[model samples]
Target: MSSTDTGARRGRPPQTPEQAEEVRARIVGATARVFTRVGSRGLSVAQIIEEAGLARPTFYRYFANAVEPLHAVLTASNAGLVGGITSALTGTDEPVELGIALIDAYLDWARGHGPMLRPLFAELHDPASPVSAYREAAFDDIRAAVRGTFTELGRPVPSPLDLDAALHVCEYVVYRISAEAGPGAQPDPETVAAARLTMIRVLLTTLGTRADVEYALEVPGLFPPPGDD
Candidate 1:
């Protein structure tokens, strides 16, 4: 018997939840690919459906418009970054250590998702775009994580405006570095390393203190050196 026939004969096959999740993932993945290629302003529902190999009806069933899948992707990415930073910080309360961990987590997430994030960043400031909502939600999550870390460390929590500014600076630095280091940019590894170090130092200094910044610099490999892979 054919593999499909044999498998069907053996038992009932897939269920709705698993199949639905797989379909949703495919839609999101396709949306990311399309956004990376054409950007948000140029994106279309038809393009996404074609990329996902789904019917138009299927696309509508899962997402309301081109922006919804993009929102879902950003939401998942932000949740993952927040979860990682939160878990990594469970027992530590030192300001420098917390700052380093948070910066590391943020950079790692950016590196992994930089291409996927480019379009979202482009649309982030547009109040009419769904990506703006997701963008604000992401910053909120990061701010909450930072506040919690400061509380744990017995340090004064930054005002919401201050936290927002710091986080935006961190994000812009990461995004700029990632764009320069992308496929054909051919940036020197040392330059990337320096950028990372500078980012960590600035963030720690802004959110914590000069002493915390100095301490982070002294801890070797606290910021991963470039080309370390």
Candidate 2:
């Protein structure tokens, strides 16, 4: 028989939870590689099976379809990104500083998840992808975190619509920043710097009071310090 159908004929099923999880991770990692190379449009079970070095039955043992692995990858990513943003909020209390920290957290995650970020960004609007629901929930989590921050500071929390809009703006900006690069590539320094500045402005306007925004503009080095560009 061909390798494609031989998994059942070859080795035993994972005897331990750890081994099962490891195998599952290999499938997820292969999904990410497929996304990086061809994006969602080109993703398929066959592609993932070959990339993961698994038989069809082997893949099916852990996942139900082509989309589950993609969803699995995104679930992990959303948790990490939202977690970072929440952590950023806890480390600072100044309104403008909070804006800075929030944006920095996003950029850090994007940079660290470079291979997957581009596809995740592209998947934002893919009707066939499960990314839309996941994206909405992830943003809501961020909004809740931001609201908690303002409540802790005794400041009025921004409206839900406003907070969501600001994040969409940043998402669009980063989408533009990384659009031209190939999968697994990062945008150049200049592009990332400019995108960061744009996002910071949108966020400040949306999340900060007028006085806070004004103070942000007047900060000589902190707002757009040397090396920021």
Candidate 3:
């Protein structure tokens, strides 16, 4: 067979960079679906090709291996997560408000992805995984943002250890919530409310001063208590 025959059978070759990127995005999208079905450890190139309805050669033309497209999927996830954090925290200076909003944004992101969120959540703790690196980098970015927030508010910055602890504590709460929920759906509002409260308590108690925590408690329904949920 000639190159022209190959091109014709492959369905018109991508004629421009944008078209090439569209094909790559299609593969990434298919990889996400396959990853959702089997989780990352069980994913395979054949599964991706089946999902994308592409030939073996076409799949190889785009990715070196099954794992490569996963990196692309997670790269987009990292952008979404970090951007979500920025949006959620942008205008808030109150400790309780910031805590609740950030957690809400995270749950919203999880809900947006449905079953796809499960494997992504698992990858957060696997240090060797691409998602883990993305997670750490995003956390560092958020930490820097927090430092800037305090500076802008004319408050003393929390120690690096305290900051890391607070973020990690909140992360653990989110992870537990994700684990408890069914893979095909988001956590119900009641569960989300509980998670919000859990993270808020961690955030206020861990990072905020005694007075900040007291003020949060003092406000009438400023931050809902665990009892409310």
TM-score against native, each model: 0.78, 0.87, 0.85
Identify the runs in model 3 with alpha carbons over 4 angstroms from their true place. 1-12, 222-229
Cα lDDT over the full model 1: 0.72
Residue-level lDDT tens digits of model 2 in 77-186: 89988999999999977889889889999988888778677777878877777877788889889989999889999999888788888999988987887777666678
Better of 1 and 3 by TM-score: 3
Please list the C-alpha lDDT of all candidates, in the order they appear: 0.72, 0.84, 0.78
Residue 27 in model 3: lDDT: 86
Residues 54-167 of candidate 1: C-alpha lDDT, one tens digit per residue: 777777777899988987777787787778777766646777766667777776676667566566566778887777777788777767877877787778888877777777
lDDT against true structure, model 3: 0.78
TM-score order of candidates, top first: 2, 3, 1
Residue 15 displacement in candidate 2 (angstroms): 2.5
Best by lDDT: 2
Model 2 clashing residue pairs (backbone): none
Q: Highest TM-score: which candidate?
A: 2
lDDT per residue as tens, model 3, 1-229: 6443432345455777876787788789999999888777888998997787777887787899999999888878877877887788775877667767777777677667777877777878887777788788888888887888778877788899888888888777777777788677767788877877777777787778888888888766546556754
Give lDDT for model 2: 0.84
TM-score for candidate 1, please give it. 0.78
Worst 10 residues of 3 by lDDT: 2-11
In candidate 1, where is summed lDDT lowest over 10 consecutive residues? 5-14
